[model samples]
Target: MKSQGGHFNKIIINRILATFLLMFVAIGIAMFLGIPNPETLLLIVLVMITSIFGMESGIVSIVMLVLYVMYFYSAEHSFLLYNRGTELAKVIVTALCSLICLLFCSLVIHKRLSKR
Candidate 1:
């Protein structure tokens, strides 16, 4: 447990780290679900989370993304999945919706934190 909640820098750093960790977890889940180019999406997610959170999370997430990409591409078996046009469109739509929701939640949190 961290007791230095009053320190703004620490709070931001912690939030970033947590966001990155979440991004990696999300990428893993997506991989399990047969998503393709998980590394690229992971990088994007890391950027989004870092933008919503901070630099530390973005940097760390990118690091993990790089590692994953290396392993993913080097593996004899495919780490990414391929989909048809319709499926790709569907995935894009779902990703857009999810990003909207994430932004909405981030806004709410930002508002609440600003009020404090």
Candidate 2:
């Protein structure tokens, strides 16, 4: 039983990493396409990912959120470049929206899984 649980955990970790990478790829595509609100697109994608992948999506969402914020801070010269309070506010809002979406997605996924 213990080994089974451990194996399950490992699978979840792998799934999270896979999902995170996919999210990054999608972000890259959005950036290239000049999406007016990549953050919103990201949140929508995250929710869909969670809905499809189940609970592991929460971890994926968190990793993506952190990396997204860091990219904004480090990119220096990009749409996400944040040099003022207003710019920073956009990041904050994106983070909050991601968190909310993750929570709702998790709950929905959990309920669905429990039914199985």
Candidate 3:
């Protein structure tokens, strides 16, 4: 599906790398503004994974979500929540972060294609 008009692998690789870079930038911004939570780290990683590869990208997104939840549940006193990661608030926050990552990559691809 990626070869009809242009090279897909390069686009994907570029997007993935750019996505990670954006995450670090986003995280750095959040940190500078005082997010004060480990969830920020998980969020940056999760968002990067979800965005870099689409929905069917792989099992990575699911696995990471589970782990984040697990850690949230076991810890009970994280800066983001109090008792594991099952809280609705935390899930929503994480999802929003992922969406941002998705948007960033989407824009990059869009710009590249548009330039052609």
Candidate 4:
């Protein structure tokens, strides 16, 4: 039983790490490709992560992405984007979409698991 619990913990850790890795890799590729808007790519990645790893990992990924945007994408590296409404809008839209995706994926997963 103890070993089973430890194995489950390891799986959780791996999923969390994978979530971050996927986000970073997507961002890197978008930057390399000179994509004007990486937020769309990130949203798709978020949905995929949520569907595969479940809501907990998805929420962590969302928070990390939000912090990244707040720091790097905002004006003066701060969340005070008083003059940059577009950046603020992007963040808001992305966060809301990710949350919707997360809820949908969670429901689908719960239904499938319950059926089994």
How large is the C-alpha RMSD of every model relative to the true structure? 7.8, 3.3, 7.6, 2.0
State residue 115's C-alpha deviation in candidate 1, in Å. Answer: 20
Tens digit per residue, CA lDDT, model 3, 3-110: 644786776666556555654565456457765454656555655565556533313443444345434444463535455344656666665655565566667756
Q: Candidate 1, residues 52-114: lDDT per residue as tens digits?
A: 775555556655665555445443534344234554454455445444545555567667779
Q: Counting only residues 3 or more apart in sequence or on different chains, how many pairs clash (N, Cα, C under 3 Å) in candidate 1?
A: 0
Using lDDT, give the best candidate's number.
4
lDDT of each: 0.60, 0.74, 0.54, 0.79
lDDT of 4 by residue, 29-71 (tens): 8768877776677778888898899888899778866666665
What TM-score does structure 3 among the candidates reach?
A: 0.39
Model with the higher lDDT, candidate 2 or 4: 4
Higher-ranked by lDDT: 1 or 4 = 4
lDDT of 1: 0.60
Descending-lDDT candidate ranking: 4, 2, 1, 3
- Summing lDDT over every window of 10 consecutive residues in candidate 2, give the lowest-scoring window: 70-79
lDDT of the structure predicted as candidate 3:
0.54
Candidate 3, position 87, lDDT: 68
- Per-model TM-score on C-alpha atoms: 0.52, 0.76, 0.39, 0.83
